[model samples]
Target: MKNEIIPYILANYPDLQTTKELLIHCHKLGIKYVELGIPFSDPSADGPVIQNAATKACINFNFDNLLAILLDLKKQNINLEITIMTYANPLYIYGISNFYTNFSSANVKGLLVPDIPFEERKVLTRKNHSIKNVWMISDNLPSASLKKIVSNSNFYLYLVAYLGTTGKNIQQSDSLKSTIAQVKKIKDIPVAIGFGIKDKNDVTNILNIADGAIIGTSLIIELDKSLNSAKEFLNNIIL
Candidate 1:
Protein backbone atom coordinates (compact mmCIF):
# COMPACT_ATOMS: atom_id res chain seq x y z
CA MET A 1 0.00 0.00 0.00
CA LYS A 2 1.11 3.61 -0.57
CA ASN A 3 2.42 4.82 2.77
CA GLU A 4 2.56 8.50 1.91
CA ILE A 5 1.74 11.48 4.16
CA ILE A 6 -1.88 10.55 4.94
CA PRO A 7 -3.76 13.55 6.38
CA TYR A 8 -6.99 12.80 8.25
CA ILE A 9 -10.40 14.49 7.73
CA LEU A 10 -13.74 14.28 9.47
CA ALA A 11 -16.27 12.28 7.46
CA ASN A 12 -19.25 13.62 9.42
CA TYR A 13 -19.46 17.06 7.89
CA PRO A 14 -22.80 18.87 7.71
CA ASP A 15 -23.52 17.60 4.21
CA LEU A 16 -22.36 14.73 2.07
CA GLN A 17 -21.91 16.92 -1.02
CA THR A 18 -19.49 19.18 0.85
CA THR A 19 -17.63 16.11 2.09
CA LYS A 20 -17.20 14.92 -1.48
CA GLU A 21 -16.00 18.36 -2.46
CA LEU A 22 -13.43 18.31 0.34
CA LEU A 23 -12.24 14.92 -0.91
CA ILE A 24 -11.73 16.42 -4.34
CA HIS A 25 -9.76 19.14 -2.61
CA CYS A 26 -7.50 16.55 -1.00
CA HIS A 27 -6.97 14.77 -4.31
CA LYS A 28 -5.98 18.08 -5.85
CA LEU A 29 -3.54 18.57 -2.98
CA GLY A 30 -1.76 15.38 -4.19
CA ILE A 31 -2.62 13.38 -1.09
CA LYS A 32 -3.60 9.85 -2.10
CA TYR A 33 -4.26 8.25 1.29
CA VAL A 34 -7.09 9.75 3.36
CA GLU A 35 -8.27 8.71 6.85
CA LEU A 36 -11.97 9.49 7.30
CA GLY A 37 -13.16 9.67 10.91
CA ILE A 38 -16.43 7.89 11.66
CA PRO A 39 -18.21 9.84 14.38
CA PHE A 40 -19.78 8.16 17.40
CA SER A 41 -21.73 9.45 20.40
CA ASP A 42 -18.81 8.89 22.73
CA PRO A 43 -15.33 9.01 21.19
CA SER A 44 -12.98 8.26 24.05
CA ALA A 45 -9.78 8.50 22.05
CA ASP A 46 -10.64 11.77 20.29
CA GLY A 47 -9.66 15.20 21.59
CA PRO A 48 -11.85 18.32 21.74
CA VAL A 49 -11.37 19.28 18.09
CA ILE A 50 -12.63 15.94 16.82
CA GLN A 51 -15.09 15.69 19.71
CA ASN A 52 -16.79 18.92 18.62
CA ALA A 53 -16.87 17.82 14.99
CA ALA A 54 -18.43 14.50 16.00
CA THR A 55 -21.01 16.24 18.14
CA LYS A 56 -22.03 18.45 15.24
CA ALA A 57 -22.06 15.53 12.87
CA CYS A 58 -24.16 13.42 15.20
CA ILE A 59 -26.67 16.18 15.62
CA ASN A 60 -26.74 17.02 11.92
CA PHE A 61 -26.00 13.57 10.52
CA ASN A 62 -25.67 10.33 12.42
CA PHE A 63 -24.77 6.70 11.59
CA ASP A 64 -27.23 6.62 8.73
CA ASN A 65 -25.56 9.74 7.37
CA LEU A 66 -22.18 8.06 7.42
CA LEU A 67 -23.56 5.05 5.53
CA ALA A 68 -25.12 7.41 3.05
CA ILE A 69 -21.79 9.17 2.53
CA LEU A 70 -20.13 5.81 1.95
CA LEU A 71 -22.79 4.90 -0.57
CA ASP A 72 -22.36 8.25 -2.28
CA LEU A 73 -18.58 7.82 -2.47
CA LYS A 74 -19.19 4.44 -4.07
CA LYS A 75 -21.63 5.74 -6.66
CA GLN A 76 -19.37 8.67 -7.55
CA ASN A 77 -16.32 6.43 -8.16
CA ILE A 78 -14.17 8.57 -5.83
CA ASN A 79 -11.32 5.97 -6.04
CA LEU A 80 -9.10 6.93 -3.10
CA GLU A 81 -7.46 4.77 -0.44
CA ILE A 82 -9.93 5.54 2.36
CA THR A 83 -9.41 4.34 5.94
CA ILE A 84 -12.15 4.59 8.53
CA MET A 85 -10.99 5.77 11.98
CA THR A 86 -13.60 4.74 14.53
CA TYR A 87 -13.92 3.33 18.03
CA ALA A 88 -14.88 -0.30 18.70
CA ASN A 89 -18.25 0.46 20.26
CA PRO A 90 -19.91 1.55 17.00
CA LEU A 91 -18.49 -1.44 15.17
CA TYR A 92 -19.67 -3.81 17.90
CA ILE A 93 -23.08 -2.15 17.97
CA TYR A 94 -23.31 -2.35 14.19
CA GLY A 95 -22.05 -5.97 14.31
CA ILE A 96 -18.39 -6.45 13.35
CA SER A 97 -19.21 -8.85 10.56
CA ASN A 98 -21.78 -6.53 9.09
CA PHE A 99 -19.46 -3.51 9.48
CA TYR A 100 -16.66 -5.27 7.66
CA THR A 101 -18.97 -6.60 4.99
CA ASN A 102 -20.54 -3.19 4.43
CA PHE A 103 -17.30 -1.25 4.61
CA SER A 104 -15.60 -3.73 2.29
CA SER A 105 -18.35 -3.37 -0.26
CA ALA A 106 -18.09 0.41 0.09
CA ASN A 107 -14.42 0.14 -0.91
CA VAL A 108 -12.92 1.17 2.43
CA LYS A 109 -9.35 -0.07 2.53
CA GLY A 110 -8.39 0.10 6.22
CA LEU A 111 -9.46 0.59 9.87
CA LEU A 112 -8.07 2.42 12.95
CA VAL A 113 -9.36 1.49 16.42
CA PRO A 114 -7.50 3.39 19.17
CA ASP A 115 -9.04 1.96 22.36
CA ILE A 116 -8.71 -1.76 21.49
CA PRO A 117 -6.08 -3.42 23.64
CA PHE A 118 -3.05 -4.96 21.99
CA GLU A 119 -3.81 -8.43 23.39
CA GLU A 120 -7.27 -8.29 21.82
CA ARG A 121 -6.03 -7.38 18.33
CA LYS A 122 -6.67 -10.91 17.19
CA VAL A 123 -10.34 -10.29 17.83
CA LEU A 124 -10.24 -7.84 14.93
CA THR A 125 -7.58 -9.51 12.78
CA ARG A 126 -9.32 -12.88 13.02
CA LYS A 127 -12.70 -11.40 12.23
CA ASN A 128 -11.49 -10.55 8.72
CA HIS A 129 -7.93 -10.84 7.56
CA SER A 130 -8.78 -8.80 4.49
CA ILE A 131 -9.62 -5.64 6.45
CA LYS A 132 -6.45 -3.64 7.06
CA ASN A 133 -6.86 -2.71 10.76
CA VAL A 134 -4.00 -0.44 11.80
CA TRP A 135 -2.92 -0.61 15.46
CA MET A 136 -1.90 2.37 17.67
CA ILE A 137 1.34 2.68 19.63
CA SER A 138 2.60 5.61 21.67
CA ASP A 139 6.02 6.98 22.61
CA ASN A 140 5.66 5.43 26.07
CA LEU A 141 5.01 1.89 24.78
CA PRO A 142 7.75 -0.57 25.66
CA SER A 143 10.06 -1.74 22.92
CA ALA A 144 9.09 -5.38 23.31
CA SER A 145 5.37 -4.63 23.10
CA LEU A 146 5.86 -2.33 20.13
CA LYS A 147 7.90 -4.94 18.27
CA LYS A 148 5.21 -7.54 18.81
CA ILE A 149 2.39 -5.12 18.00
CA VAL A 150 4.01 -3.81 14.83
CA SER A 151 4.94 -7.32 13.77
CA ASN A 152 1.34 -8.45 14.12
CA SER A 153 -0.09 -5.43 12.28
CA ASN A 154 -0.74 -6.02 8.58
CA PHE A 155 -1.64 -2.55 7.40
CA TYR A 156 0.26 0.17 9.30
CA LEU A 157 1.41 1.02 12.83
CA TYR A 158 0.08 4.33 14.20
CA LEU A 159 2.77 5.84 16.43
CA VAL A 160 1.51 8.48 18.80
CA ALA A 161 4.23 11.10 19.36
CA TYR A 162 3.08 11.90 22.90
CA LEU A 163 0.73 10.70 25.62
CA GLY A 164 -1.65 13.66 25.44
CA THR A 165 -4.81 13.95 23.34
CA THR A 166 -4.67 15.31 19.78
CA GLY A 167 -4.42 19.10 19.26
CA LYS A 168 -1.94 21.93 18.80
CA ASN A 169 1.38 21.37 20.53
CA ILE A 170 5.07 21.76 19.92
CA GLN A 171 6.77 19.45 17.44
CA GLN A 172 7.98 16.11 18.70
CA SER A 173 10.98 16.76 20.93
CA ASP A 174 14.39 15.00 20.98
CA SER A 175 12.95 12.10 22.96
CA LEU A 176 10.49 11.57 20.12
CA LYS A 177 13.42 11.54 17.72
CA SER A 178 15.04 8.78 19.75
CA THR A 179 11.76 6.88 19.88
CA ILE A 180 11.36 7.15 16.10
CA ALA A 181 14.92 6.00 15.63
CA GLN A 182 14.19 2.96 17.76
CA VAL A 183 10.98 2.24 15.86
CA LYS A 184 12.83 2.64 12.56
CA LYS A 185 15.20 -0.13 13.59
CA ILE A 186 12.31 -2.57 14.01
CA LYS A 187 11.45 -2.67 10.28
CA ASP A 188 8.07 -4.38 10.41
CA ILE A 189 5.17 -2.58 8.72
CA PRO A 190 5.33 1.14 7.84
CA VAL A 191 5.46 3.34 10.95
CA ALA A 192 3.18 6.37 10.58
CA ILE A 193 3.50 9.19 13.13
CA GLY A 194 0.45 11.10 14.38
CA PHE A 195 -0.90 13.34 17.19
CA GLY A 196 0.28 16.96 17.60
CA ILE A 197 1.51 17.39 14.04
CA LYS A 198 0.44 20.99 13.43
CA ASP A 199 2.09 22.58 10.40
CA LYS A 200 4.16 22.21 7.23
CA ASN A 201 7.36 22.11 9.24
CA ASP A 202 5.90 19.11 11.04
CA VAL A 203 5.44 17.39 7.67
CA THR A 204 9.13 17.82 6.74
CA ASN A 205 10.22 17.10 10.31
CA ILE A 206 8.30 13.83 10.68
CA LEU A 207 9.24 12.63 7.18
CA ASN A 208 12.84 12.34 8.35
CA ILE A 209 12.04 9.63 10.91
CA ALA A 210 8.79 7.90 9.91
CA ASP A 211 7.34 6.59 6.68
CA GLY A 212 4.30 8.92 6.94
CA ALA A 213 2.58 11.53 9.11
CA ILE A 214 -1.07 11.56 10.15
CA ILE A 215 -2.38 15.10 10.85
CA GLY A 216 -5.88 15.05 12.32
CA THR A 217 -6.66 17.81 14.83
CA SER A 218 -5.05 20.50 12.71
CA LEU A 219 -6.98 19.40 9.66
CA ILE A 220 -10.23 19.24 11.61
CA ILE A 221 -9.78 22.75 12.94
CA GLU A 222 -8.93 24.07 9.49
CA LEU A 223 -11.88 22.26 7.97
CA ASP A 224 -14.15 23.77 10.57
CA LYS A 225 -12.83 27.27 9.96
CA SER A 226 -13.09 26.78 6.23
CA LEU A 227 -16.49 25.21 6.16
CA ASN A 228 -17.48 27.53 3.36
CA SER A 229 -14.22 27.31 1.41
CA ALA A 230 -12.49 23.97 2.00
CA LYS A 231 -10.56 24.10 -1.24
CA GLU A 232 -9.02 27.44 -0.48
CA PHE A 233 -8.33 26.34 3.08
CA LEU A 234 -6.55 23.19 1.97
CA ASN A 235 -4.67 25.00 -0.76
CA ASN A 236 -3.28 27.40 1.81
CA ILE A 237 -1.72 24.43 3.64
CA ILE A 238 -0.92 21.93 0.87
CA LEU A 239 0.35 24.40 -1.71
Candidate 2:
Protein backbone atom coordinates (compact mmCIF):
# COMPACT_ATOMS: atom_id res chain seq x y z
CA MET A 1 0.00 0.00 0.00
CA LYS A 2 1.08 3.61 -0.51
CA ASN A 3 2.07 5.79 2.41
CA GLU A 4 -1.34 6.79 3.78
CA ILE A 5 -1.73 10.43 4.65
CA ILE A 6 -5.00 10.28 6.56
CA PRO A 7 -6.73 13.51 7.44
CA TYR A 8 -9.50 13.45 10.03
CA ILE A 9 -12.65 15.56 9.80
CA LEU A 10 -15.31 16.07 12.41
CA ALA A 11 -18.58 15.71 10.50
CA ASN A 12 -21.17 18.49 10.41
CA TYR A 13 -18.64 21.00 11.64
CA PRO A 14 -20.03 24.29 10.50
CA ASP A 15 -22.00 22.21 7.98
CA LEU A 16 -21.77 19.06 5.89
CA GLN A 17 -21.18 20.88 2.62
CA THR A 18 -17.82 22.18 3.74
CA THR A 19 -16.94 18.76 5.14
CA LYS A 20 -17.68 17.07 1.82
CA GLU A 21 -15.68 19.66 -0.06
CA LEU A 22 -12.72 19.23 2.25
CA LEU A 23 -12.86 15.43 1.88
CA ILE A 24 -12.95 15.75 -1.91
CA HIS A 25 -10.02 18.08 -1.76
CA CYS A 26 -8.09 15.54 0.26
CA HIS A 27 -8.71 12.85 -2.30
CA LYS A 28 -7.66 15.13 -5.08
CA LEU A 29 -4.45 15.71 -3.22
CA GLY A 30 -3.76 11.95 -3.37
CA ILE A 31 -4.82 11.15 0.16
CA LYS A 32 -6.33 7.68 0.39
CA TYR A 33 -7.69 7.58 3.94
CA VAL A 34 -10.34 9.71 5.61
CA GLU A 35 -11.33 9.34 9.25
CA LEU A 36 -14.79 10.86 9.79
CA GLY A 37 -15.19 11.88 13.42
CA ILE A 38 -18.70 11.62 14.84
CA PRO A 39 -19.75 14.27 17.28
CA PHE A 40 -20.71 13.35 20.84
CA SER A 41 -21.76 15.22 23.97
CA ASP A 42 -18.75 14.16 26.02
CA PRO A 43 -15.61 14.04 23.96
CA SER A 44 -13.27 13.81 26.91
CA ALA A 45 -10.29 12.43 24.99
CA ASP A 46 -10.30 15.35 22.58
CA GLY A 47 -8.54 18.71 22.97
CA PRO A 48 -10.19 22.12 22.83
CA VAL A 49 -9.96 22.30 19.01
CA ILE A 50 -11.62 18.94 18.45
CA GLN A 51 -13.96 19.48 21.40
CA ASN A 52 -15.31 22.69 19.94
CA ALA A 53 -15.82 21.06 16.55
CA ALA A 54 -17.62 18.14 18.20
CA THR A 55 -19.93 20.50 20.09
CA LYS A 56 -21.13 22.07 16.86
CA ALA A 57 -21.07 18.78 14.98
CA CYS A 58 -23.22 16.97 17.54
CA ILE A 59 -26.23 19.06 16.62
CA ASN A 60 -26.19 17.76 13.03
CA PHE A 61 -24.60 14.34 13.41
CA ASN A 62 -26.87 11.34 13.95
CA PHE A 63 -27.28 7.81 12.63
CA ASP A 64 -29.39 8.94 9.72
CA ASN A 65 -27.19 11.89 8.92
CA LEU A 66 -24.06 9.75 9.02
CA LEU A 67 -25.49 7.14 6.68
CA ALA A 68 -26.74 9.80 4.32
CA ILE A 69 -23.35 11.47 4.18
CA LEU A 70 -21.52 8.18 3.54
CA LEU A 71 -23.98 7.23 0.85
CA ASP A 72 -23.55 10.61 -0.73
CA LEU A 73 -19.78 10.19 -0.78
CA LYS A 74 -20.13 6.79 -2.39
CA LYS A 75 -22.50 8.12 -5.04
CA GLN A 76 -20.11 10.92 -5.87
CA ASN A 77 -17.24 8.47 -6.31
CA ILE A 78 -15.18 9.90 -3.46
CA ASN A 79 -13.69 6.44 -3.26
CA LEU A 80 -11.36 6.40 -0.27
CA GLU A 81 -11.13 4.32 2.87
CA ILE A 82 -13.75 5.91 5.12
CA THR A 83 -13.43 5.26 8.84
CA ILE A 84 -15.83 6.38 11.57
CA MET A 85 -14.37 7.83 14.75
CA THR A 86 -16.82 8.28 17.58
CA TYR A 87 -17.27 7.59 21.25
CA ALA A 88 -18.91 4.38 22.49
CA ASN A 89 -22.04 6.13 23.68
CA PRO A 90 -23.07 7.12 20.16
CA LEU A 91 -22.55 3.62 18.84
CA TYR A 92 -24.41 1.93 21.71
CA ILE A 93 -27.39 4.27 21.45
CA TYR A 94 -27.50 3.96 17.67
CA GLY A 95 -27.60 0.18 18.12
CA ILE A 96 -24.22 -1.44 17.44
CA SER A 97 -25.63 -4.03 15.06
CA ASN A 98 -27.16 -1.43 12.80
CA PHE A 99 -24.20 0.93 12.91
CA TYR A 100 -21.53 -1.56 11.83
CA THR A 101 -23.60 -3.30 9.17
CA ASN A 102 -24.72 0.00 7.72
CA PHE A 103 -21.21 1.46 7.66
CA SER A 104 -19.90 -1.68 6.00
CA SER A 105 -22.48 -1.43 3.26
CA ALA A 106 -21.77 2.26 2.94
CA ASN A 107 -18.13 1.33 2.15
CA VAL A 108 -16.63 2.35 5.47
CA LYS A 109 -13.28 0.61 5.94
CA GLY A 110 -12.66 1.07 9.68
CA LEU A 111 -13.80 2.26 13.12
CA LEU A 112 -11.92 4.23 15.79
CA VAL A 113 -13.44 4.73 19.23
CA PRO A 114 -10.77 6.30 21.44
CA ASP A 115 -12.75 6.00 24.67
CA ILE A 116 -13.56 2.27 24.41
CA PRO A 117 -11.00 -0.04 25.90
CA PHE A 118 -10.09 -3.16 23.89
CA GLU A 119 -11.40 -5.54 26.58
CA GLU A 120 -14.95 -4.09 26.67
CA ARG A 121 -15.39 -3.59 22.92
CA LYS A 122 -16.91 -6.96 22.11
CA VAL A 123 -20.19 -5.56 20.84
CA LEU A 124 -18.50 -3.25 18.37
CA THR A 125 -16.36 -6.00 16.86
CA ARG A 126 -18.83 -8.89 17.03
CA LYS A 127 -20.87 -8.04 13.92
CA ASN A 128 -18.58 -9.34 11.13
CA HIS A 129 -19.05 -6.04 9.33
CA SER A 130 -15.51 -6.06 7.81
CA ILE A 131 -14.96 -2.64 9.29
CA LYS A 132 -11.60 -2.84 11.03
CA ASN A 133 -11.53 -1.80 14.70
CA VAL A 134 -8.66 0.65 15.21
CA TRP A 135 -7.09 0.79 18.67
CA MET A 136 -5.26 3.85 19.98
CA ILE A 137 -1.87 3.27 21.60
CA SER A 138 0.96 5.39 22.91
CA ASP A 139 4.62 5.06 23.90
CA ASN A 140 3.71 4.15 27.47
CA LEU A 141 1.70 0.96 26.82
CA PRO A 142 2.80 -2.00 28.89
CA SER A 143 4.64 -4.78 27.15
CA ALA A 144 1.81 -7.29 27.58
CA SER A 145 -0.93 -4.81 26.69
CA LEU A 146 0.90 -3.47 23.64
CA LYS A 147 1.50 -6.95 22.34
CA LYS A 148 -2.14 -7.87 22.90
CA ILE A 149 -3.42 -4.68 21.28
CA VAL A 150 -1.22 -5.12 18.22
CA SER A 151 -2.21 -8.77 17.91
CA ASN A 152 -5.91 -8.06 18.31
CA SER A 153 -6.14 -5.07 16.03
CA ASN A 154 -7.53 -5.80 12.55
CA PHE A 155 -5.98 -3.16 10.31
CA TYR A 156 -3.30 -0.64 11.25
CA LEU A 157 -2.57 0.27 14.86
CA TYR A 158 -3.08 3.93 15.89
CA LEU A 159 0.15 4.97 17.61
CA VAL A 160 -0.34 8.18 19.50
CA ALA A 161 2.68 10.55 19.15
CA TYR A 162 2.30 11.48 22.78
CA LEU A 163 0.06 10.87 25.76
CA GLY A 164 -2.30 13.76 25.30
CA THR A 165 -5.58 14.82 23.65
CA THR A 166 -6.17 15.24 19.89
CA GLY A 167 -4.40 18.59 19.53
CA LYS A 168 -1.05 19.87 20.88
CA ASN A 169 2.52 19.83 19.60
CA ILE A 170 4.56 17.09 21.23
CA GLN A 171 8.27 16.83 20.66
CA GLN A 172 9.66 13.59 19.34
CA SER A 173 11.07 11.31 21.98
CA ASP A 174 13.19 8.18 22.08
CA SER A 175 10.29 6.48 23.82
CA LEU A 176 8.00 7.18 20.83
CA LYS A 177 10.60 5.77 18.45
CA SER A 178 11.14 2.73 20.64
CA THR A 179 7.38 2.15 20.86
CA ILE A 180 6.86 2.12 17.09
CA ALA A 181 9.94 -0.03 16.59
CA GLN A 182 8.61 -2.56 19.07
CA VAL A 183 5.17 -2.56 17.47
CA LYS A 184 6.78 -3.20 14.09
CA LYS A 185 8.73 -6.10 15.55
CA ILE A 186 5.49 -7.67 16.85
CA LYS A 187 3.19 -7.02 13.88
CA ASP A 188 3.52 -6.79 10.10
CA ILE A 189 0.57 -4.49 9.50
CA PRO A 190 0.76 -0.73 9.05
CA VAL A 191 1.31 1.42 12.15
CA ALA A 192 -0.23 4.90 11.91
CA ILE A 193 0.52 7.75 14.32
CA GLY A 194 -1.74 10.60 15.40
CA PHE A 195 -2.17 13.24 18.11
CA GLY A 196 0.36 16.11 18.11
CA ILE A 197 1.16 15.62 14.44
CA LYS A 198 1.15 19.31 13.54
CA ASP A 199 3.28 19.96 10.45
CA LYS A 200 5.79 18.72 7.88
CA ASN A 201 8.49 18.13 10.46
CA ASP A 202 6.12 16.03 12.52
CA VAL A 203 4.92 14.00 9.54
CA THR A 204 8.42 13.54 8.17
CA ASN A 205 9.75 12.24 11.45
CA ILE A 206 6.74 9.96 12.02
CA LEU A 207 6.85 8.37 8.56
CA ASN A 208 10.38 7.19 9.31
CA ILE A 209 8.88 4.54 11.63
CA ALA A 210 5.17 4.60 10.79
CA ASP A 211 3.32 3.65 7.62
CA GLY A 212 1.08 6.70 7.89
CA ALA A 213 0.17 9.71 10.03
CA ILE A 214 -3.35 10.54 11.23
CA ILE A 215 -3.82 14.30 11.33
CA GLY A 216 -6.86 15.80 13.05
CA THR A 217 -6.71 19.02 15.05
CA SER A 218 -4.16 20.80 12.90
CA LEU A 219 -6.21 20.13 9.79
CA ILE A 220 -9.38 21.16 11.58
CA ILE A 221 -7.74 24.38 12.70
CA GLU A 222 -6.87 25.08 9.08
CA LEU A 223 -10.28 24.10 7.79
CA ASP A 224 -11.64 26.52 10.33
CA LYS A 225 -10.04 29.22 8.24
CA SER A 226 -11.35 27.99 4.85
CA LEU A 227 -11.73 24.75 2.88
CA ASN A 228 -8.55 25.48 0.96
CA SER A 229 -6.55 25.57 4.14
CA ALA A 230 -6.68 21.77 4.41
CA LYS A 231 -5.30 21.33 0.91
CA GLU A 232 -2.66 23.92 1.63
CA PHE A 233 -1.62 22.14 4.80
CA LEU A 234 -1.24 18.84 2.94
CA ASN A 235 0.91 20.47 0.28
CA ASN A 236 3.06 22.29 2.79
CA ILE A 237 3.45 19.24 5.02
CA ILE A 238 4.31 16.79 2.26
CA LEU A 239 6.64 19.07 0.35
Report the number of the highest-lDDT candidate.
2
Candidate 2: C-alpha lDDT:
0.82
The local lDDT score (0 to 100) that residue 117 gets in candidate 1 is 73
Q: Candidate 1 lDDT, tens digit per residue, 1-239?
A: 33466778777565667677777667767877778887766778778888887877766655556666667767887667778888887777777777777777666778888778788875575454366877888778888997787766677777787877777574658877776667667765677788888777887788777788888787777667776455665566566
Query: In model 2, where do residues sit more than 4 Å from their true spots?
Result: none
What TM-score goes with each of the models? 0.87, 0.94
How accurate locally is residue 234 in candidate 2, as Cα lDDT from 0 to 100?
Answer: 73
Residue range 63-179, candidate 2, lDDT tens digits: 777688778878988788888888988888998878877888777888899888787767675745688888988887789999999888778888888777878886778887788
